[model samples]
Target: MTQALVDGTVIRGHGVASGHASDSPYPAGTIAMQQPYFAALGLDLTGLYLATINLDIQPAQWRLLQADYTFRALRWTDLHPPEDFSFIHCQLLWQAQRYAGYIYYPHPATKIQHFQSPRMLELVLPWIATISYGARARLIYRAEQIQIEPAALL
Candidate 1:
């Protein structure tokens, strides 16, 4: 796979990705909740963070038209309907360091709630330190997995 990079901002997200909200039913976080399902589908995500890092690619929009792994009709939660998700190989670049990661694409079309912005991408990676919202970061992704339109508005 060809590697490419894009600059984005670490933005505050719905805070539900990790399922850590006080009212959240899943204590381990959503990523953890969905882990078994993905594993069943042959996508093992062991040891990754139980949360997701929200990244906003401003001055551009992105689409996960193709991915390294795609799971459809996943009924991971009982509260909502089924959802589709796609995972693309990527690395999160911060402070001159690269961390193994994946571009977490929970398809809005199949989701019944928590719709994300087109400019946003949910990332899954191992634990990192001192990261905060509004921080600028870079994404090193497989060129064929995600199509980022730099000139696209909003």
Candidate 2:
């Protein structure tokens, strides 16, 4: 039941709640909370897209990747998050384009009530508007780097 990453397709996520709460599509709180962490790790979030690109991966495929990636939840306050709150950094590829970003793990509270599929992958990038729904994309792990390309479909 595991689908190949190369065969994966990108779907519209309606964007994360954090993004919708702000003027821009990007998630302000989530990004703000993670900024210090990224800074401490010497990673820069300024160059990346602040919103998430939803990926529709098969359950089996998601399980396979979950086994390999580390899942960490960011809980700054007790308020129930409107979307997934966990994430892992990785690379992605789509239409011959490459990107570096993280795969967000939607919060269980939000997923059970909001998402239609259990096999959901959220990509948080600096240039998320590049890709639109129904685009073909792939997630790759090479040299510990995660790159996604064709960030915007249009």
Candidate 3:
């Protein structure tokens, strides 16, 4: 399998992931609460941050045809019904640093809130002190696992 690289820009996202959303109903953050459940299911997210960094790979949108891991009807929160999630291995390159992470995808068909745009590819990475909104980054992924195609003309 060939790994392809695409450049993207870091963008701000709904604060629900980091639990920093002032008006968010889930103050503790979605990931923080779901961590334990995912861990118990075998994905130990020990060193990874509890938040996801939204990356805009615009002019290109992603399709989740296949996932390295998928959890169906995960009962991680009581606020809403269980939602499905999928993740794929993602490699990031930023400022001469290479990061190993995952492309976090919450199945929209089952998701009830915090909807994300198709142009944005949410990533779960380790705590990176230098990363900030508006930074440029590149992601390496397998085409078969995560299909990226040109955005439809509007």
Candidate 4:
């Protein structure tokens, strides 16, 4: 176990820029753990959520994460296409007042996702090399249940 202080708070984990397993295709890494851990720590994602990725070779860029967004959003575009991108390290910034979060220069191959419950969020992620980086790792999510009620008639 390792410990580090962030914003005066102590966080105990493996180390800097590590990964966590969440499912078959995603591996456990710092990039994959941030937001979900924040959510588990009680940070709400009901509003806008953004993750920024920077490459060692270029300036940083960001994207707003949506429910139906594709895998491309979390990937490092500049280093992608021919070469596989792997997240070497990153830093996260959050706007609690705006209900927004920012991930700066996430390592290549780092991925993030959202879930409604803590129980369902504990799954492990598979290794990207085995599955290939360009492949889309589909999240298995529970559909929201709808309730029906009697309507008032004239």
Question: Higher lDDT: candidate 3 or 4?
Answer: 3
Worst 10 residues of 4 by lDDT: 115-124
Q: Order of candidates by lDDT, top first?
A: 3, 1, 2, 4
TM-score of 3: 0.95
lDDT value, candidate 4, whole model = 0.25
Q: Give the TM-score of candidate 4.
A: 0.18
Off by over 4 Å in 1: 151-154
Residue range 7-111, candidate 4, lDDT tens digits: 211122222234333442324444444445345544333332222211111121122222221222432223323211211111222222111122232223443
lDDT of the structure predicted as candidate 1: 0.85
Clash pairs for candidate 1: 18-29, 18-30
**What are the models' TM-scores?**
0.92, 0.58, 0.95, 0.18
Candidate with top TM-score is 3
How well is each residue in 2-85 modelled by candidate 2, as lDDT tens digits? 322434678766544345653443356455565666456455567866666777765323422342233245443345443334
User: lDDT value for candidate 3?
Assistant: 0.89
> Which segments of model 2 are wrong by more than 4 Å?
1-4, 21-29, 32-44, 64-73, 81-86, 106-116, 142-154
Superior by lDDT: candidate 2 or candidate 4: 2
Better of 1 and 3 by lDDT: 3
Error of 3 at 92 (Å): 1.0
Off by over 4 Å in 3: none
